[model samples]
Target: MPYLPARAVATLRLLFATLLLAPLAAQAQAEPDGDNSQSPYFSVHSDDPANDRLPLKSTQVRARVLGVIADVTVTQHYRNEGSRPLEAQYVFPASTRAAVYAMQVRIGERQLNASIREKQQAKQEYEAGKLAGKTSALLEQHRENVFQMNVANILPGDEVAVELHYTELLVPTDGVYRFVFPTVVGPRYNGALATGSGTAEPWIATPYQCTAATTDAVGAAAIDESAPVFDLQVQLATPTPVRELVSPSHAIDIDKGADNQSRVRLAAATTIANDRDFILDYRLAGDRIESGLLLSKGSEENFFLALVAPPKAAPSQLIVPREYLFVVDISGSMHGFPLDTAKVLLQRLLAGLRPSDRFNVMLFSGSSSLLAPDSQPANADNIARALTLLDTEMGSGGTELLPALRQALAVPGDQERARSFVVITDGFVTVERDAFELVRKHLDQANLFAFGIGSSVNRQLIEGLARAGQGEPFVVLDKASAAEQAERFRRMIDAPLLTHVQARFEGLDTYEVEPPALPDLFAQRPLVLFGKWRGEAKGRLLIEGQQAGGAYRVELPIRADQAQAENQALALLWARHRVASLTDQETLEGDFAYSQAILDLGLKYHLLTPYTSFVAVDEVVRTAPGTSPAATPQPLPLPQGVSPLAVSPLTVGAAVPSTPEPSTWAMLLIAALGGLLLHRRGPRGAGGTV
Candidate 1:
């Protein structure tokens, strides 16, 4: 200190003071109103006024269920209410495994069907159509579950309707079937986004509806008239009586039609905003999941799907000690309601741990922190201490997930105990592909289970993590459902229903089975297999497994006469599952080995894939001779129960950043210290001042 002159000392003190107050100043500016904080706090207004900015009016969904297969069609109506010609772009979600095979657009009375084309080719065609003053609609897949729709040239007072058709096979678990219709695409946090990075996801640039000024008791934003109205109806048909049919997400009215048929629709009195996921669950009479074969004989190809029921979980007397690492998200998105729900879930999860298990908790946001240096015993004292520490986190900052994941995997552990990583979050980050690859590379170390803790979580990331790690995905739509979901997860982890599974083809000639090797049946989900059959379907399929320390076998006979045209979805379903497998393989072996194969599959099947898209163009010009349509990205509603903190409107075109946030004043101090150290250590010129 004595070596420094009075001038240098004063300069250092002034610099330190500025550094200490910088974040405090920023905090004041960010939350000036205390309710809404827009990052990069500026709004971009279109040339048109707010009244005409939104062209999308309504969306209608209809689903028909044939036993376990569901065919769904979603129709979106875009109306040009204002005087200007408009182009509307909407980003939405779908089931991760949905096979979108068709899309069509209707204008007045003329209807034009969309054609599946290579992604670049489709984009070119859509752009050409738009440039030619023609009406066009383009559908593209940005992620497995996320999609974007672009409709061009809607003249004044003209209403154009676009319908997308897809099919998904509903696999039941624990004799309970679930059908999920994702309604909104939550804002994504892109860690790689930077100026000149060029790799930023364009979809994240879209706008989201803001209603933080008023929040309901459940912390859901109030729906304004600008939101599109949604209507959903499901025709459920089963081979046996459907019992306990219910929807945990929406209030519905059910009408029993036939002996095994039911019509379900959203109650007219209920709110119709598409702000959260629509989920339906049901069980067959006697809670029995049928084990059978579905045969689809196409003119060119023959496909078959098999489902073999696994035995119920047997209570185990011998318990094995295990290691559990719980990864939790405490980001700004979890600031209010979401954070509360996560706390409740973690409480239940920690309390339910077995006394023999060793457990630890890792809370992550911009950075990660561990409850302890190493795994702690699941004792009352440790549990209380851990919970107390977790309770202090109020949830702030960006969601930097990969660093936390790497840290969790790097921890040294005992190889003898079975290990599992449980992650709980809203799954809102854009680094899902990287996360999946990370989990896939470490499968030898432990399995990963993901719990999405919001009304409209990113199912793609949650399910992908589980899929990559050979575990399962769970969602807690709200706080009320957290306890039930947590209990189910704990039970599933402890009980293995079947093991040592093997499937063999007999007289039936089968080829190219999607999953060549089957995993041990931990939950009550059936062993499902997809393949192509040749010659005839008359054969016996045999499967063997171990249950409760005893050998178990099941054989199902397939008859050639049982082939049905109603099972036409099987061929497309097989292709979708194959694409998924190839995708996983592509991630594992990085050079895109399966790229061409996936492209060929998409082209051959005319299905929507990462490599292909659907585009529809009306030949006739829609806009006037001189006027051009204004392109408007549709604003999506804040997924129900999500806080405004999640969608910070943080970046160029409204995307969130993936950097450490000024969560506390201490962060400012740390930054100041860093600057101070750098200043003192930096090299000086020969004639250094003072």
Candidate 2:
């Protein structure tokens, strides 16, 4: 062997050490198997070895639809199987439009109603309660659609139940009313953990748990045997007879009763995993669209909700050349069903394009690539090329959407041609506000439509993108509905029912109307409005807009005396909407006043928000003060239709190395050091070498 110089020898030793440790490090970070279960990413760990994991026991969902509004209640049961006390934390998802109003905590025979407080105040209260050895629970909103529930100081063998209630309005799309209830919060990809505490989002710091199985069967079975089962039921009360009732996501049993009422529940013995959203869709008899006003009276203030239908539009005689830009997400989260759905939707949309129109396709994952530098003519050749590009170049990577969106917006287009930008994705991104701001900034350039594809797509991002883009949001949970969804999208954009719409109140003391300015009406969906009014309820609410032929106007008489006390839900719903609008504005303006307003509104209406939280406590001491309760994270189910491999390191049941054993690097370093020492010692342990 050639004699190596001292510097070279040192360098080689270091390189060898690195090579030995690299794989060891990776394996060490691998997810754990069921035999040695551990928390995945974005989870907090407990100190007590016995209280390592807190398993969710069960989830029950009940929904009641009265007219066009739905009141939903969800109950989650958690059990502490360990010997020591533990603090359980769970991160979950909900509908974007849901107006959460109440939360309750049940411990054995005692039920505690949570009270909403400013976020910081609630956190302080929860910590104090924990320190005082009291049992407590806290509910906080992490994102518009994501929430966190924390239960502190649950004694061993205790089964605690958390109940949450929310209400939302049902806006029919294409004459069909759809209700979505999301069950799982998909694992978020965080490149690195947060450096400091007290960050705005604490759940991001929770550690992640990797499981050993990826397939549906193995994944479902690999979960803790104590994991919770789900039970869901819905009572639908519509004024008109339902022509059909269906649940594409779940096997459901529907019982139709007299008076246009029906009851729906999950089919018997149906093994439902909390991996997919539960969707219920119904069509009314004759497919008629009805619009009306709802009023509610309170001791202090009065509220009103109005839905106005626009006149049907006639077929356009003038053919307008338009430019269409399609943005598709090829992120790892959208590997299987979501990507397939996008492809099917895009094909249908491309086929419907007129020859006079121009289109381009942009696929993005970690980076973006456009089919052409500019928009291409919608001819057979370009369409074929686009399809081929989709086939060859579409692959999964990190979800870097902002850059792709920026590139799409920067693509120069023909000034005279109308522009419509369609975005297809599972919306698995946390930077929703940034995306919305970008769309809002480019509203003058193109009309933005968002298509959310997946069993439990991010509705907040989808709806926000459309609202900012001045268009509509469409969701397709299954591939079978792609064609119908595409057709609906085409019809919605092809004609405008009304434009430049404005609402005016005469002889009414109306104030704080949400969505101060209305966008053009594209479909038969109602124009919904929520506002506060004073004085006698006798006033004329006038809606004005320009139709195909001329100006259009409709007036509805409002009577304050008709306000019913039972409609208190209207007030809470309106407050929630106002808070959402204010939060969006706050995100854009970075104003503290908007933040304060949201906090005040949340406290007033008892709504959980980013600036507010719900907290409940029991007076009795549960755990000792010096002995801290272990912080246990609850694992969420893998979303339906999402492959286990799609999640990689976060796979539900996949066996992954949590930590690597001692690597060869130690041996290499030891050998290298020993060689250097022997070289220094020379022959026979003498100082000098011959």
Candidate 3:
């Protein structure tokens, strides 16, 4: 295998590749015969391209070439490690931009180079001619060149390795060159089923960097340097190699060991420096962030403020004993990760409740149920039983948010406390305006806190409900995030820091600020405010927040010496009041324009809207008002590009062409012809060695 020179072998590899791909171009057109049914087991079929999801009978690949000039010949190997028989079909996407010198397939113990040929079909010729320098033919659908044959049968426990050897023209470029191997799970003829699973891992390696440049020079600010001769190594796990270790920023050396395990070592080599900063990010397994802080020659004091909110307000402060109610959504979609995570968070919140606090739990689906016949104060035995009962409940039925909200509010609970309702859901419904109106009507001293789950949660509805109920809203993106949000809830239940926060600045003209009214601050959630600032610095302002029974007043001395501090103090005051105003809208005396601005901004930026989301690219501009000063211009639509792996179930057949090639007698004819021809010719001698 290692007998030939590299230069002479490169020429021979190009020659054989051309011969194996000519026929596919002549008969590439296939139509769709739609049949949609759920089949438990995978099917294999030939002839119909639409049936390409299935496998075919069997195949064989043979390759060879001698490179006389380079003094090295490429060696190839093939293996079949698959459960069912693999009908291997190799198709080199016809390329006019770059010539493929050689290709190989690995099946069981044999490795052979693929036969290549120039596709003469009119469409293939036209496409090949048009693709002058493009690296990919994703936009062009017709041009193809490659060989695909089937392995009549591969029993359960099988593996295949295909090694191709050829001299590829090393094209020099200034930017980072990325060579991505296709890993889509599709037809073999498409040359897309390139990913592995379970214990095996597929790897790709490239040689050294050629040059170096700064991030700005390349437009990717995060990358400090772009080297010319960059060595890139990538691996995807599969059955043969069960575990593979790789780092995003370095090269990993992989070697097969004697004990059925692969050893991988990642080594970092080059460092790129930039004008702004140079920092190394490393998370050694599960360790927290370890940072190095450089100090100036003289400075020593590290002024830090750790604000720990107290548990429960004092009697003299703004006393708002909340009448707490829980509305839990148990819909069918929440059955999996969503509902399970929600249950754990709710139990934590319940545990934080004090003896005097009144609460009730309402579970909802198509119908709603209460934890107890009536609301009761939190007690050790009752709260514990409530948590246990929630575990036994399962999510099912349609999401009926309207009725659920109504039932939760109407539930006879602790009316004596300042009422507050907590609703947890994946936000799967679209009950818009009506739901908001209902929340507003039923809302009183009780504010609403909404916890949302899943990627498609209706942020608008949940946030809107919270706004109406004068509460807070949080989202759980995945299982990991559930704990954080749960902690926020626990903190809120533990104590109320400040209540009824209001601010009036004398130095500047009135400007926009968020959270008009402040809510009682809990330990977990940080109190942040948003708004525009204006005017010159002047006098000191007053800071007043109710603790337990009485109001605590502090003078925020705004010295001209500390101008920035004064403005920030003013901004913080504005933010705190804005938040309070949002929740306490019913008590406001003016128009709802301030709250409206918050809602408008949320929709514009696709922020955590109470009820909506910019689900698709088009939704980015759909509801945002064009005339508004805050409106962002919609981007122009671009042509769709092909993806590697169809990861999302939603993207399955939509991106690919609807019509699939039919598997029938025609496939058998091509297979028989190719097999007979290949056998008769018997792989033109040894052309190249690995």
TM-score top scorer: 1
Which of the predicted structures, 2 or 3, would earn the higher TM-score when compared with the native? 2
Better of 1 and 2 by TM-score: 1
TM-score of 3: 0.39
Q: Sort all candidates by TM-score, best to worst.
A: 1, 2, 3
Model 1, span 296-383: residue lDDT tens: 8877778999999888777775687889999999987776788889999999999889998999999988788999988999999999
Work out candidate 3's RMSD over C-alphas: 24.8
What lDDT score is found at residue 350 in candidate 3? 80
Q: After superposition, how far is residue 315 of candidate 3 from its true place, in Å?
A: 11
Whole-model lDDT values for every prediction: 0.82, 0.77, 0.38
Estimate the overall C-alpha local distance difference test score of candidate 2: 0.77
lDDT of 2 by residue, 133-157 (tens): 9989998898889999889898888
Candidate 2 Cα deviation (angstroms), residue 235: 1.2
TM-scores, all models, native as reference: 0.88, 0.85, 0.39
lDDT of 3 by residue, 1-690 (tens): 224446445644554333222322221222112221110011112343322222221221121111100111222111233332222322222111112233344444544333322222322422332222111011111211111222212223434333332211111111111121211111111111121101111100000111222222112223322111112222222223233233332344665555333433334443321111111111122221111111111121111111122223333323345557788876544654567777877876787676777778888765678888777778888888778877865454445677777777677655467677888986544343456667777666467888876433545556667767666777664556667677766655544556666544455333454445455653323233334433443444444576555675544333333433322223222333333345245223334545555444334322221211111011112111312111011111000011101011111122211111122223544565454444445445663322
Instruction: Give me the displacement of residue 237 in model 2, in angstroms.
Output: 1.4
Candidate with more favorable, higher TM-score: 1 or 3:
1
Candidate 3 stretches with Cα past 4 Å from truth are 1-323, 355-358, 377-385, 432-434, 454-463, 474-490, 512-515, 523-535, 554-690
Comparing 2 and 3 on lDDT, the stronger one? 2
